[model samples]
Target chain A: MDTEEIYREMANSIVSLDQEKAVHLANQALDESMDLLQVIEKGFGEGIRKVGDLWDEGEFFLPELMSGAQIMEKAVDIITPGLQSSGSERQSSGKVLLATIEGDIHSIGKTIVATMLKANGFQVVDLGTDVKAEKIVDEAIKGDIDIIGVSTLLTTTMVNQKKVIDLLNQKNIRNKFKVIFGGAPVTQGWVDECGADGYAENAVESVKLVKELIQ
Target chain B: MLFTNWLEDKSKIILFDGAMGTQLMNRDLEPGKIPDLLNIENPEVVKKVLASYYDAGSDMVQTCTFSSNVVSLNRHNISNLYQKINVEAINNIKAILPSEENLIVGDIGPSGEFRPPVGNASGDMWKAGFQKQAKILAPGIDLWHIETISDLQEMSAAIQGIKEVSEKPIIASMTYRKTKTRGFFTIMGDSVETCVTKLEEEKVDVIGTNCTLGSDQMIELIKELVNLTDIPISAKPNAGQPRLSGGNTLYDQPVEDYVNDIGQMIDLGVKIVGGCCGTTPTHIRKIRTLIDSR
Candidate 1:
């Protein structure tokens, strides 16, 4: 099958949450020995975007979306290095640090965004859950990350998202690292209230929003 | 009329607590993560809360071990220390008894991971997860409370594993997303009657719903459930509904509102009753006083 067909098939495996099938199709695409970049850009990236569309249309739930991202991440784990050596050259989008804010330990959403960003050619530093605001800013400053995305699944922890964003401005790093927020409790109103750079409904959109801002 | 010898001679549906996460929050636990760990990590706080339920109206205070399973423990980077933490958790609760006939229940909650048919989680993986905790807790607890269960497939497997580990009465509660709008079905579109039937088929000692929604929703489901099985029913709902404020998770339900309803549960023929999310000793105190008055 063509690389395009392979990518679509791979995307479907992700949607189906079929890790083995995803890996199988990705390996078949690899055997064709086609341009890995074309496979990733046309195949994986587009595949996940399609998955994102499913989420937007309400055809998919949180588990489905997260599984798709996991599939994509596993596939990338196998293919990214190969593409890097092929000379098509992966994009070196700036490094981004992401986490679920304090009082909220749910990381399924944040993990999805990290997976998508890495697939889309951005270096992402993930700090996991219940991350304090100071820890987030310190990482951003030390790493000089291009953007910091904060996730909060609970309302109690949502304030920490704002706290981290506010701390960013307080430390005069607001301009240095763009701040974004997302998660169940995080809303557009929250974004506006916290003076955040942007907010997305899911990890895929968060990746898109970050890419747009940095570009 | 599910038959449970909870008190040896008491013949009635069992009542469980409502909104533990909701209750703990009122006791000062921020939402997200394993708030149940307060049982060991802060037993003084946990003891005060559980003891209050005994004073208020609880025949049993479930030991804090809802997320004691390895899967939930892994969330707090305690996966490597699951055996140690879970054992300590149960031991701590057992240490501070009410000096009454009250029992200690070991709570087992969902793993939050997908299982076969929906996801790739293996039965062995799941059985291992529950067994690891149950084995450690069963010897200590008066009974094992398996709740917030979503998968029907794992219900029997969990019960069988627990039976292998302990002869303690295992009260199995499923977390169905019941609503007045959609009576007796879960968020995954499971019917309460069907779930209860499945649990009954497994012959679980006690069966009912916990987490998701509140007392009113649970009451609605029980209206259907109590009639379905002659077995005693269990209902542990949330603190009404969690409200998001200032980015912090809050349970806005009042204690009197909760206490005022224990009679309703009893009137509906509920045998056992306690609080879950928004419940504290104060709420249990009211429930106890109300029950005594009856």
Candidate 2:
């Protein structure tokens, strides 16, 4: 198959959740000396964006979206180093530190945001779920992150999102990094109340919000 | 007699307890630690929460085993205490029940592992984790309450697991989101119609939505469900939409407002009603009063 057909097939494999086919196509692209950036943008990136669109339209569900993300992650892992070594221009967006605040174990929403942000060129440092405010602040300081995104799925844990901001303020570094809050229980009102810089209801909007913040 | 039989004999709606994790947190259960651990290490704290529900006129109280499955427990590095966590949670709730008539539900929640082609967890893993907890808690509990589930596949796997261990009736509930399109659907995109059809197929004794939406949204969802299923429908909405205030997530619905919504749920023929996140004994007491008046 030509490069275009191979890219199309790779995109189809991700949407179909065909992990093997996605991997095979990714490898085929690599072996055929396809432009690594073209493969990423046209194949894996296009595939995940389609999945996101389906999710937005309610035609695809969490499982399908997650599987597509997994496939994209795998293909990207295979292509990223090759692209870098080939001297392709690396698009560096702002760095983001993400976590599900302490007391909450809900990671799916935060994970989706991380995937979407990565797809949109943001460098995300995910601290995983049940992350403490102190740890989030410490990571932000250490990583020189531009944004700290905290999520909570439980009402009981929503306070922790604020606590992270509080800790940042206590350290006198709150102004240095923008903070975004999200999850099922979080609202725009909560984002303002928690002193977060922004809020996104879903992953797609999250990427947009991050872009706007950085810009 | 079975709990389902007893439920049928009662003419009134059954009231389940609300918000165990939040109640426990209020009682000083530390953040980020497993709440189920309290069942084994601090039965008094667990008992206190259950006792409050019982005092609030809850006909049934769920054990603090919502996250006791091996998959969830393993995340907390306490998978070794999985059996003890579930069994003790049931035992603590059973201890606090005023009588045998008061039910102790074996609470099973999401496994925290997504089943493949999305995540690494297999169907067998989900089933085994649920079955392990069910097997341990089934003896002490009156029935199984699988709740806060978002995925249909996981919900089906849980039902199959519970059925494998016991003939007890299962109350299966999924947490749904009100889509931008104004349609009721689970986080995984399972519509109310889809959930009702599938839950009925799985032979769940009761089916409904829980956790995500508040009682107002739940009333609308229950209306949709009432049209589809002949089985008992439960509605365990949050106290209200959560709003952050002074760094705390507060559910703003007044007790009266919550009970009023429950009244609407009852008017629409919802047989089982209770609270999910942000609900307290106050909410349950109000609901009890509403149900009693009816």
Candidate 3:
């Protein structure tokens, strides 16, 4: 197949969540001496971007986004070594620390955000769920992170999102990192109340919000 | 026990309790710890919370075991406390009730892991996790109540697992978000009609929406559900949509407003009415008064 056809197949494989086809295309591209970064950017990248768009439009749900993410991650895993060996520039937008705030165990929202951020060239350190504010702040400072994203599904746990910011201020280093919050219960009012830098309603907006915050 | 049997009759509306996590937070629950773990470590605390709900005239009180499933417990690295937590949670609720007639729902929440081909967790894993919790809590519980489930696939797996351990009636509820185009659908994309149809097909004793939308929005969703099935419908809406005020997440619906909204639910043939997030005992008390007045 021509390069354009191969890229189209790769993108289609991700959109369809056909992991085997995605991997086979990645391997075929490599064997044909296709540029690995081009495969990642145009193939896996375009596919996931479309998946994100579908998700934004509510045409896709968590299962489809997650499946698509896994497929992209798989293809990226196969291509990363080649890009590294060829000394291609694999620039990251920034590092983000993501977690579901303390007292909340819901992780799907945060996981989706993590997946999307990773796909968009952001380094994400996921702290799972029910994470304490102090721990989140400590990691932000220690890891030199650019952004901290807190997620909480429970109304009660939403306070902990602010607690992370409070801890950062108490440490007198609040200006060091941008803080973003999201979840079912979160609103723009909560973002302001918590003194968070930004808020995203969903995974797609999360990437955009992070980009805006960093810029 | 009389009320427990009557719940199956579906001749009258049943009143389930309001939010447990918020009530516990009021009782000084440390934020990061698993609330279910409180059952094993502080049964008195768990018992006190259950007692308040029962005192508020909740005919049925759910155990403090919402997140006790293996997947969630393991996430906190406390999987070994799973059986103890579920067993103690029921025991604590049982200890508080004045009579065995008062139903104790073995509450189950989502496993916090998406089932494949979306995530790594398989259907077998979802079934196993829920089954493990069900078996442990089966001895003291009168029925199973799965609440705040967003995914239909996960809900199906949970019900299947719970059925393997007990023949008790299961009340399966999904949390839904209102979409402009679809009307009302779960975050996982199960619409009100779709979810009700699926839950009915699964033969769950009760089916409805809970957690995300408030009673106002829920009344409309419940109306849609009531149209789809003859099965008794339940509505456990949040007090209202959440708002941020002074760093606190506050639900805008007051007890009167909530009770008022729920009155419409009752009018529309909803058989089971309760509160989800942001609801308090006062809300439950008001609901009781409404039921009594009716």
Candidate 4:
């Protein structure tokens, strides 16, 4: 197949959520001596972008989004060695640290956001669930993160999102990284009240929010 | 048998208590604290909530065990209290129950653990946790009420778990979100038709929808649910969508608006109706007035 055809196939694999097809295409692109970076950005990257659009349009749901991310991650894994051996690196748009605040064990939403951010060219460090505000702020500072995304599904736990911001401000480094809050119960009003940079309703909007804040 | 008798009259409306969590919040249950722990920490407070629902004219009241299952307790570092929490949740309600005429539903919420590709939580884990809760709660509860689950697999697991422990009638409710492209679906993409088909296969006594959507959207979902199954339908929609203000989450849907939409749900042939998040005893009282007038 032509290079353009190969890119289309790679994109299609992700949209269809076929991990095997995506991995096969990634290996094929490498065997054909294709530019690894282009395959990732133009091929798999375009596919994830489409997934995000589909999600926003309400044609896709959380399972589809999570599955698509898993597929994209697998394809990217297959192509990573090739890029390394060629003395090249895939440039990330920014680094984001993610967590589900203290007293909340909800993980699905936060994990989807991490994967979606990865697909959109952002490096993500996910601290998993029930994370304390102190630990979250400390990790952001330690990681030199560009953005901090805090998620919570419970109203009781959402207050921790504000605590993270309060802790950041207390440290006098609140402006060093953009902080975005998300979860089922989050809203723009809450974001404003908590002094967060933005609030996203779901994983797809999370990617857009990060992009806007980072820029 | 009691459950069957309550539903014997096809035209009679079955009224359930409104939100347990919402009532607890009103009672100054600390935010972020595990609500189920109240059963152990302060049984009186839990009993008071159940008594209020009965006073509000609810035919059925749910136990405060929505999060008392093994999986959720483990998440909160209270795994040791699993059996105790489930037992107390039922006994606390049973203590203040006005009479046998008022049914006690064994409230079961989601595992807060997703199954399969969504996460690593296996179906067996879900089944085991649900079975344990049901086993402890079976004797005291009039029926099994599993609500707010978005995943079909998890819902199936819960049914199988409860079945393993008891023969009580089961009411399985899934939460749905209104989509822009497709009509309505669980966050995991289980459509109403799919849910009905699966719940039927399990021979569940009732198929229902609760949480995520407000009373108005629930009216739309009930229309779809009633068309898909012969099983009795139950709906427990939230007061409305949660909004954030002044560091608190509020469900600002007016009681008049909520009760009016509920009136529409009753007209749609919904056999069992109640409230989910943000709903109060006042809402249940209003629903009682609506159902009694019929």
Over B1-294, each residue of candidate 3 has an lDDT whose tens digit, in order, gives 454466566567799999888777667777556678888888888888788889999989999998899987887788898978887787788788867557888899988776666457777898899999999888888888898888888899999999988998888988888765657777777777778778888999888678878788887787788788888878899888778686455677668989999999999888888898889889999999999998
Better of 3 and 4 by DockQ: 4
For residues A1-215, write the lDDT of model 2, one tens digit per residue: 67788889878887787889988888887787888777878887788878877777777777777777877888777777777778884466899999998878878788888887886567999999888899999988999999999998766677777888788888898899999998877888887776789888788778778989998
The candidate 4 chain A region of ten consecutive residues with least summed lDDT is: A152-161
Order of quality (TM-score): 4, 2, 3, 1
Return the DockQ of model 3.
0.47
Can you list each candidate's DockQ?
0.18, 0.50, 0.47, 0.69
Give the alpha-carbon lDDT of every model: 0.70, 0.84, 0.84, 0.88
* lDDT per residue (tens digit) for residues A29-145 in model 4: 889889999999999999999999998877888878888988898888888889999999899899999999997888888988998999888999999988999999999989999
Residue A64 Cα positional deviation in candidate 1, in Å, after optimal superposition: 4.5
Error of 3 at A98 (Å): 2.7
- TM-score each candidate: 0.71, 0.88, 0.88, 0.97
**Any runs in candidate 3 off by more than 4 Å, and if so which?**
A1-9, A28-39, A81-87, A100-107, A127-144, A153-157, A170-173, B1-11, B99-101, B244-249
Give the C-alpha miss distance for residue B47 in model 3, angstroms: 3.1
- Candidate order by lDDT, decreasing, is 4, 3, 2, 1
lDDT tens digits, residue span B1-294, model 2: 657675586576888898988788677666567788998889999899899999999999988998999888877778899977877787788788898778888899999887554457878889998888889988887888899998888899999988998998889999988776648887677888988889999989888678878888888888888899888888899888777676455677888888899999989988888999889999999889888887
Write one digit per residue (lDDT tens) for candidate 1, span B2-27: 12355355543344444455456666
Tell me what TM-score chain A of model 3 achieves. 0.94
